[model samples]
Target: MEEAHSSRYSIHPGSTKMYRDLREVYWWNSIKKGIDEFVAKCPNCQQVKVKHQRLGGMTQNIELPKWKWEMINMDFITEFPRS
Candidate 1:
Protein backbone atom coordinates (compact mmCIF):
# COMPACT_ATOMS: atom_id res chain seq x y z
CA MET A 1 0.00 0.00 0.00
CA GLU A 2 2.78 2.41 0.91
CA GLU A 3 4.64 1.68 -2.30
CA ALA A 4 1.49 2.03 -4.39
CA HIS A 5 0.63 5.32 -2.67
CA SER A 6 4.08 6.94 -2.67
CA SER A 7 6.00 5.38 -5.53
CA ARG A 8 7.08 7.63 -8.40
CA TYR A 9 4.70 5.89 -10.77
CA SER A 10 1.76 6.02 -8.36
CA ILE A 11 2.34 9.56 -7.06
CA HIS A 12 -0.23 9.46 -4.29
CA PRO A 13 -3.40 8.85 -6.24
CA GLY A 14 -6.66 9.86 -4.56
CA SER A 15 -8.62 7.24 -2.66
CA THR A 16 -10.91 6.39 -5.57
CA LYS A 17 -8.13 5.83 -8.05
CA MET A 18 -6.00 4.06 -5.51
CA TYR A 19 -8.84 1.76 -4.64
CA ARG A 20 -9.45 0.99 -8.27
CA ASP A 21 -5.80 0.25 -8.96
CA LEU A 22 -5.42 -1.87 -5.87
CA ARG A 23 -8.60 -3.84 -6.46
CA GLU A 24 -7.19 -5.11 -9.73
CA VAL A 25 -4.69 -7.23 -7.81
CA TYR A 26 -5.94 -7.11 -4.23
CA TRP A 27 -9.13 -7.15 -2.29
CA TRP A 28 -10.32 -7.29 1.27
CA ASN A 29 -13.19 -6.31 3.48
CA SER A 30 -13.56 -2.56 3.93
CA ILE A 31 -10.85 -1.87 1.33
CA LYS A 32 -12.48 1.31 0.11
CA LYS A 33 -12.77 2.64 3.62
CA GLY A 34 -9.14 1.75 4.25
CA ILE A 35 -7.97 3.60 1.17
CA ASP A 36 -10.04 6.63 2.07
CA GLU A 37 -8.60 6.64 5.55
CA PHE A 38 -5.09 6.19 4.21
CA VAL A 39 -5.40 9.11 1.84
CA ALA A 40 -7.02 11.29 4.50
CA LYS A 41 -4.12 10.61 6.81
CA CYS A 42 -1.44 11.20 4.19
CA PRO A 43 0.16 14.59 4.81
CA ASN A 44 1.24 14.90 1.18
CA CYS A 45 -2.24 14.20 -0.08
CA GLN A 46 -3.68 16.69 2.42
CA GLN A 47 -1.22 19.35 1.31
CA VAL A 48 -2.19 19.13 -2.36
CA LYS A 49 -5.84 18.18 -2.09
CA VAL A 50 -8.09 19.98 -4.50
CA LYS A 51 -11.08 21.79 -3.03
CA HIS A 52 -14.38 20.89 -4.70
CA GLN A 53 -16.47 24.02 -5.02
CA ARG A 54 -18.54 25.93 -7.51
CA LEU A 55 -16.23 27.56 -10.02
CA GLY A 56 -18.44 30.43 -11.24
CA GLY A 57 -21.75 31.79 -10.00
CA MET A 58 -24.60 33.01 -12.14
CA THR A 59 -23.45 34.61 -15.40
CA GLN A 60 -23.72 38.38 -15.67
CA ASN A 61 -25.81 39.87 -18.43
CA ILE A 62 -23.87 41.61 -21.18
CA GLU A 63 -24.81 45.10 -22.32
CA LEU A 64 -26.52 45.22 -25.72
CA PRO A 65 -24.37 46.45 -28.59
CA LYS A 66 -25.27 49.98 -29.64
CA TRP A 67 -23.23 50.11 -32.86
CA LYS A 68 -22.22 47.85 -35.74
CA TRP A 69 -19.12 45.65 -34.99
CA GLU A 70 -19.38 46.76 -31.37
CA MET A 71 -19.37 43.10 -30.44
CA ILE A 72 -17.21 41.05 -32.78
CA ASN A 73 -16.86 37.29 -32.73
CA MET A 74 -14.11 35.25 -34.37
CA ASP A 75 -12.95 31.63 -34.38
CA PHE A 76 -9.53 30.35 -35.30
CA ILE A 77 -8.94 26.79 -36.41
CA THR A 78 -5.57 25.32 -37.25
CA GLU A 79 -4.61 22.38 -39.49
CA PHE A 80 -7.23 22.98 -42.14
CA PRO A 81 -6.80 21.18 -45.47
CA ARG A 82 -6.19 23.51 -48.42
CA SER A 83 -8.61 23.27 -51.34
Candidate 2:
Protein backbone atom coordinates (compact mmCIF):
# COMPACT_ATOMS: atom_id res chain seq x y z
CA MET A 1 0.00 0.00 0.00
CA GLU A 2 2.77 2.45 0.88
CA GLU A 3 4.62 1.54 -2.30
CA ALA A 4 1.56 2.19 -4.42
CA HIS A 5 0.90 5.46 -2.73
CA SER A 6 4.50 6.71 -2.99
CA SER A 7 5.75 4.83 -5.99
CA ARG A 8 7.54 6.34 -8.98
CA TYR A 9 4.70 5.52 -11.41
CA SER A 10 2.03 6.83 -9.05
CA ILE A 11 4.07 10.04 -8.71
CA HIS A 12 1.95 11.29 -5.80
CA PRO A 13 -1.20 11.85 -7.85
CA GLY A 14 -4.28 13.13 -6.06
CA SER A 15 -6.61 10.82 -4.18
CA THR A 16 -8.91 10.29 -7.15
CA LYS A 17 -6.13 9.32 -9.54
CA MET A 18 -4.55 7.11 -6.91
CA TYR A 19 -7.86 5.39 -6.24
CA ARG A 20 -8.40 4.75 -9.95
CA ASP A 21 -4.90 3.44 -10.48
CA LEU A 22 -5.11 1.15 -7.45
CA ARG A 23 -8.47 -0.15 -8.59
CA GLU A 24 -6.86 -1.38 -11.77
CA VAL A 25 -5.23 -4.23 -9.83
CA TYR A 26 -6.36 -3.99 -6.23
CA TRP A 27 -9.55 -3.80 -4.20
CA TRP A 28 -10.46 -2.71 -0.74
CA ASN A 29 -13.49 -1.64 1.26
CA SER A 30 -12.25 1.88 2.13
CA ILE A 31 -10.07 2.50 -0.91
CA LYS A 32 -11.11 6.10 -1.37
CA LYS A 33 -10.73 6.97 2.29
CA GLY A 34 -7.39 5.24 2.49
CA ILE A 35 -6.10 7.03 -0.55
CA ASP A 36 -7.24 10.35 0.87
CA GLU A 37 -5.42 9.66 4.09
CA PHE A 38 -2.30 8.57 2.27
CA VAL A 39 -2.21 11.64 0.08
CA ALA A 40 -2.87 13.89 3.03
CA LYS A 41 0.19 12.45 4.72
CA CYS A 42 2.43 12.49 1.68
CA PRO A 43 5.29 14.94 2.24
CA ASN A 44 6.01 15.44 -1.46
CA CYS A 45 2.41 16.26 -2.26
CA GLN A 46 2.24 18.68 0.64
CA GLN A 47 5.46 20.39 -0.41
CA VAL A 48 4.47 21.04 -4.04
CA LYS A 49 0.69 21.36 -3.94
CA VAL A 50 -0.67 24.84 -4.68
CA LYS A 51 -2.30 26.57 -1.74
CA HIS A 52 -6.09 27.16 -2.07
CA GLN A 53 -6.26 30.50 -0.28
CA ARG A 54 -6.74 33.88 -1.89
CA LEU A 55 -3.67 35.92 -2.81
CA GLY A 56 -2.87 39.34 -1.36
CA GLY A 57 -5.63 41.91 -1.88
CA MET A 58 -5.31 45.17 -3.78
CA THR A 59 -3.90 48.25 -2.01
CA GLN A 60 -3.85 52.00 -2.71
CA ASN A 61 -1.89 54.88 -1.22
CA ILE A 62 -3.91 57.51 0.68
CA GLU A 63 -1.41 60.35 0.49
CA LEU A 64 -2.61 63.78 -0.79
CA PRO A 65 -0.84 65.80 -3.49
CA LYS A 66 0.38 69.34 -2.63
CA TRP A 67 -0.82 70.88 -5.91
CA LYS A 68 -3.25 70.20 -8.80
CA TRP A 69 -2.10 67.48 -11.23
CA GLU A 70 0.72 66.67 -8.82
CA MET A 71 -0.54 63.14 -8.35
CA ILE A 72 -2.00 62.79 -11.85
CA ASN A 73 -0.33 60.50 -14.36
CA MET A 74 -0.47 60.21 -18.16
CA ASP A 75 0.69 57.76 -20.79
CA PHE A 76 1.42 58.64 -24.43
CA ILE A 77 1.00 56.05 -27.18
CA THR A 78 2.11 56.19 -30.83
CA GLU A 79 1.44 53.66 -33.55
CA PHE A 80 3.73 52.95 -36.49
CA PRO A 81 3.09 50.96 -39.66
CA ARG A 82 4.83 47.63 -40.03
CA SER A 83 6.93 47.82 -43.19
Candidate 3:
Protein backbone atom coordinates (compact mmCIF):
# COMPACT_ATOMS: atom_id res chain seq x y z
CA MET A 1 0.00 0.00 0.00
CA GLU A 2 2.75 2.44 0.93
CA GLU A 3 4.68 1.65 -2.25
CA ALA A 4 1.61 2.14 -4.47
CA HIS A 5 0.72 5.35 -2.67
CA SER A 6 3.93 7.21 -1.79
CA SER A 7 6.43 5.90 -4.35
CA ARG A 8 7.83 8.13 -7.14
CA TYR A 9 5.70 6.39 -9.76
CA SER A 10 2.42 6.62 -7.83
CA ILE A 11 2.88 9.97 -6.02
CA HIS A 12 -0.05 9.55 -3.60
CA PRO A 13 -3.13 8.86 -5.68
CA GLY A 14 -6.55 9.39 -4.08
CA SER A 15 -8.53 6.50 -2.57
CA THR A 16 -10.58 5.74 -5.71
CA LYS A 17 -7.63 5.54 -8.11
CA MET A 18 -5.56 3.65 -5.57
CA TYR A 19 -8.33 1.11 -5.13
CA ARG A 20 -8.65 0.63 -8.90
CA ASP A 21 -4.93 0.08 -9.28
CA LEU A 22 -4.59 -2.22 -6.28
CA ARG A 23 -7.70 -4.33 -7.00
CA GLU A 24 -6.18 -5.79 -10.20
CA VAL A 25 -3.33 -7.50 -8.30
CA TYR A 26 -4.73 -7.77 -4.76
CA TRP A 27 -8.07 -8.27 -3.06
CA TRP A 28 -9.35 -8.29 0.47
CA ASN A 29 -12.60 -7.81 2.33
CA SER A 30 -13.41 -4.16 3.10
CA ILE A 31 -10.54 -3.01 0.92
CA LYS A 32 -12.33 0.15 -0.12
CA LYS A 33 -12.78 1.15 3.50
CA GLY A 34 -9.11 0.49 4.13
CA ILE A 35 -8.02 2.62 1.18
CA ASP A 36 -10.32 5.41 2.23
CA GLU A 37 -8.91 5.33 5.74
CA PHE A 38 -5.35 5.25 4.48
CA VAL A 39 -5.87 8.26 2.19
CA ALA A 40 -7.68 10.19 4.89
CA LYS A 41 -4.78 9.63 7.27
CA CYS A 42 -2.09 10.61 4.71
CA PRO A 43 -0.72 14.02 5.68
CA ASN A 44 0.53 14.83 2.14
CA CYS A 45 -2.92 14.19 0.67
CA GLN A 46 -4.60 16.34 3.34
CA GLN A 47 -2.23 19.24 2.75
CA VAL A 48 -2.96 19.48 -1.01
CA LYS A 49 -6.60 18.26 -1.22
CA VAL A 50 -9.04 20.69 -2.83
CA LYS A 51 -11.78 22.08 -0.56
CA HIS A 52 -15.37 21.54 -1.74
CA GLN A 53 -16.91 24.42 0.18
CA ARG A 54 -17.82 27.85 -1.22
CA LEU A 55 -15.46 30.78 -0.62
CA GLY A 56 -16.19 32.89 2.46
CA GLY A 57 -17.77 36.43 2.31
CA MET A 58 -19.85 38.12 -0.38
CA THR A 59 -18.47 39.68 -3.59
CA GLN A 60 -18.28 43.47 -3.87
CA ASN A 61 -19.28 45.46 -6.96
CA ILE A 62 -16.91 47.95 -8.57
CA GLU A 63 -18.35 51.39 -9.31
CA LEU A 64 -18.63 52.44 -12.95
CA PRO A 65 -16.62 55.42 -14.19
CA LYS A 66 -18.80 58.58 -14.35
CA TRP A 67 -16.52 60.45 -16.83
CA LYS A 68 -13.70 59.86 -19.28
CA TRP A 69 -10.49 58.64 -17.55
CA GLU A 70 -12.30 58.74 -14.20
CA MET A 71 -10.62 55.53 -13.17
CA ILE A 72 -7.14 54.88 -14.46
CA ASN A 73 -4.84 51.98 -13.69
CA MET A 74 -1.14 52.17 -14.53
CA ASP A 75 1.87 49.93 -14.02
CA PHE A 76 5.44 51.12 -14.57
CA ILE A 77 8.81 49.39 -14.31
CA THR A 78 11.84 51.70 -13.98
CA GLU A 79 15.47 50.62 -13.79
CA PHE A 80 17.80 52.76 -11.69
CA PRO A 81 21.57 53.13 -12.13
CA ARG A 82 23.62 51.21 -9.58
CA SER A 83 26.19 53.32 -7.65
Candidate 4:
Protein backbone atom coordinates (compact mmCIF):
# COMPACT_ATOMS: atom_id res chain seq x y z
CA MET A 1 0.00 0.00 0.00
CA GLU A 2 1.26 3.45 -0.86
CA GLU A 3 1.48 5.88 2.02
CA ALA A 4 -0.67 8.95 1.56
CA HIS A 5 2.24 11.10 2.65
CA SER A 6 5.88 10.11 3.01
CA SER A 7 9.56 10.79 2.42
CA ARG A 8 10.73 7.28 1.50
CA TYR A 9 10.59 6.09 5.09
CA SER A 10 8.79 2.82 5.55
CA ILE A 11 5.57 3.22 7.49
CA HIS A 12 5.07 1.23 10.63
CA PRO A 13 1.86 -0.72 10.42
CA GLY A 14 0.60 0.85 13.61
CA SER A 15 0.99 4.39 12.21
CA THR A 16 -0.44 3.66 8.80
CA LYS A 17 -3.47 1.74 9.99
CA MET A 18 -4.36 4.29 12.64
CA TYR A 19 -3.98 7.20 10.24
CA ARG A 20 -6.27 5.63 7.65
CA ASP A 21 -8.77 4.12 10.03
CA LEU A 22 -8.66 4.87 13.71
CA ARG A 23 -10.71 1.79 14.55
CA GLU A 24 -8.44 -0.60 12.69
CA VAL A 25 -6.55 -2.81 15.09
CA TYR A 26 -3.30 -4.21 13.80
CA TRP A 27 -2.65 -6.92 16.34
CA TRP A 28 0.97 -7.93 16.40
CA ASN A 29 0.15 -11.25 18.01
CA SER A 30 -2.70 -11.83 15.59
CA ILE A 31 -0.54 -11.69 12.47
CA LYS A 32 1.75 -14.42 11.20
CA LYS A 33 5.42 -14.45 12.20
CA GLY A 34 6.23 -14.27 8.52
CA ILE A 35 4.95 -10.69 8.34
CA ASP A 36 7.64 -9.57 10.72
CA GLU A 37 10.24 -11.71 9.00
CA PHE A 38 9.48 -10.03 5.71
CA VAL A 39 9.62 -6.53 7.17
CA ALA A 40 12.89 -7.26 8.88
CA LYS A 41 14.23 -8.15 5.45
CA CYS A 42 13.60 -4.55 4.41
CA PRO A 43 17.06 -3.00 4.80
CA ASN A 44 15.63 0.48 5.36
CA CYS A 45 12.46 -0.54 7.17
CA GLN A 46 10.70 1.94 4.83
CA GLN A 47 9.20 -0.46 2.33
CA VAL A 48 5.43 -0.64 2.29
CA LYS A 49 4.83 -4.34 2.15
CA VAL A 50 1.68 -5.57 0.51
CA LYS A 51 -1.02 -7.15 2.61
CA HIS A 52 -1.81 -10.78 1.85
CA GLN A 53 -4.79 -12.94 2.66
CA ARG A 54 -4.41 -14.43 6.11
CA LEU A 55 -6.00 -17.85 6.71
CA GLY A 56 -6.56 -18.03 10.44
CA GLY A 57 -8.74 -16.43 13.08
CA MET A 58 -8.20 -15.75 16.78
CA THR A 59 -10.30 -13.90 19.31
CA GLN A 60 -8.64 -12.93 22.56
CA ASN A 61 -10.19 -11.50 25.71
CA ILE A 62 -7.49 -8.78 26.07
CA GLU A 63 -8.11 -8.24 29.75
CA LEU A 64 -6.08 -5.06 29.94
CA PRO A 65 -7.84 -1.76 29.37
CA LYS A 66 -6.12 0.75 27.10
CA TRP A 67 -2.74 -0.90 27.76
CA LYS A 68 -0.54 0.61 30.46
CA TRP A 69 1.50 3.59 29.26
CA GLU A 70 4.93 1.98 29.42
CA MET A 71 4.30 -1.72 29.45
CA ILE A 72 2.95 -4.43 27.22
CA ASN A 73 0.05 -5.51 29.33
CA MET A 74 -2.02 -8.43 28.08
CA ASP A 75 -3.33 -9.90 31.31
CA PHE A 76 -3.86 -6.80 33.43
CA ILE A 77 -3.06 -3.11 33.51
CA THR A 78 -3.35 -0.26 35.97
CA GLU A 79 -5.54 2.70 35.08
CA PHE A 80 -2.83 5.19 35.99
CA PRO A 81 0.23 6.16 34.00
CA ARG A 82 3.39 6.56 36.03
CA SER A 83 5.17 9.86 36.15
- The candidate, 2 or 3, that scores higher on lDDT is 3
**Model 4 lDDT, residue 66, Cα:** 68
TM, every model: 0.60, 0.55, 0.61, 0.22
Number of clashing pairs per prediction, in order: 0, 0, 0, 1
Which residue pairs of candidate 2 clash? none
Model 4: pairs clashing at backbone N, Cα or C within 3 Å: 10-46
Model 4 global lDDT (CA atoms, 0 to 1): 0.45
Ranking by lDDT: 3, 1, 2, 4
lDDT of 1 by residue, 1-83 (tens): 89989999999988999999999999999999999998899998887765643456788998889999889988998998999
Higher-scoring candidate on TM-score, 1 or 2: 1
Model 1 CA deviation exceeding 4 Å by range: 52-83
Candidate 3 lDDT at 70 equals 83
In model 3, which regions exceed 4 Å deviation?
A: 52-83
Q: Give me the displacement of residue 51 in model 3, in angstroms.
A: 1.2
- Residue-wise C-alpha lDDT for candidate 2, range 23-49, written one tens digit per residue: 999988988898898889888888777
Model 4 C-alpha lDDT per residue in residues 1-83, reported as the tens digit of each score: 23412235644454434344423544445344535454455544543434443645787675565646745537665788878
Candidate 4's error at 44, in angstroms? 1.1
